[model samples]
Target: MSTPDQPAAFKPPANDPWKGFRGVCSGTLILESIVVFLAIPAIAKLGEGVGAGAVVYLVVLGVVMILACGVQSRPWAMGLNLGLQVALIAGWFVHPAVGAMGLLFAAVWVYMLYLRKDIQARIERGLLPGQRD
Candidate 1:
């Protein structure tokens, strides 16, 4: 279908995209956990003052995020990840900064989901180079 003046679209070698996807998800969770941990100082200094409850909540949530990374390959993992996002957004009650961070990361996750869908579509359509030959 390509004209002499026009090159065909590039198709990467077919491979297990989900492997890299899991890695990306894990990395994102780790980074989000770091950001959540970093928000502790802000919460302590700026908000109603870091009470024991706030500290515990943030620390626990960060730990949960880290732990969630380990289960990224599970069927329930996406639901769990989405649930964590809701929990993070709920942190607004603790501090607006925490909620804002949640919103930011939520956007990132949404984009990731969109890309996942696209990849799945490509696989189904045999668009990958490995699929071609």
Candidate 2:
């Protein structure tokens, strides 16, 4: 309630929630890249000796994941991330451990997407803290 001469207090607009989400996605990619790199030693020793081509493939995929981190804000970034997951799973040809790692990360991505949808629904309902009157 305000008097005729008194103005209502000012409230700043809500922050862009997706900004933090992008950071999380970037960090996850970096972690995934490290894991992919670490799998190299296992690939060489545990399996029937990894081929030079297979090693090169893993290295390139890891590097691509790191590079993808820089573009997390783009609209197509999610598509690229999902594509990489598929590539990792396809690593079945190279080694089963690599494929298992991909499956684990894919589950993580599914959960992240579910959280994204929940946030969007909250925003639409004006249920976020900043949206309150």
Candidate 3:
């Protein structure tokens, strides 16, 4: 306990939950961005006027999420995703079939967010690699 010139003892983590969840969420965002981007042209051709705007917005938002949060404390990412979900579901009232597919995407996004929240909490509590922000 007396350590004027000595450093404290180092203790490694029992496990790193943050890294695993980070990988999953980051990968999911990348994949979802790709899918949405690719589908944009087709959707536009199908006469969905908002397709381009939606694709651009999603791609930009996903990149920003990765940069700002990197799947760690990704509050922006999760919130934006949930917002999209609500939008998609509301869209169902206008176009049932199309919105149904959107709902599936929304469901997947929500699941990913659910999986990442635990990691975010850990990070916030100073249980992960970095210090609290």
The best candidate by lDDT is 2
Per-residue lDDT of model 1, residues 2-46, tens digit only? 589976555565687788888999999999999999999977888
Clashing pairs in 2: none
Worst-scoring 10-residue span by lDDT in model 1:
7-16
Ranking by TM-score: 2, 1, 3
Q: Which segments of model 2 are wrong by more than 4 Å?
A: 1-13
Over 4 Å off in model 1, which ranges?
1-14
Model 2, 1-133: lDDT tens digits are 5578985454442887788889999999999999999999978899488999899999999999999999998999988999999999999889999999999999988888887898788777667778667
Global Cα lDDT for candidate 3: 0.57
Pairs that collide in candidate 3 are: none
Residue pairs with backbone atoms closer than 3 Å in model 1 (clashes): none
Better of 1 and 2 by TM-score: 2
Give per-residue CA lDDT, model 3, range 7-30, as digits (tens). 434434466665666576666656
| TM-scores, all models, native as reference | 0.86, 0.87, 0.49
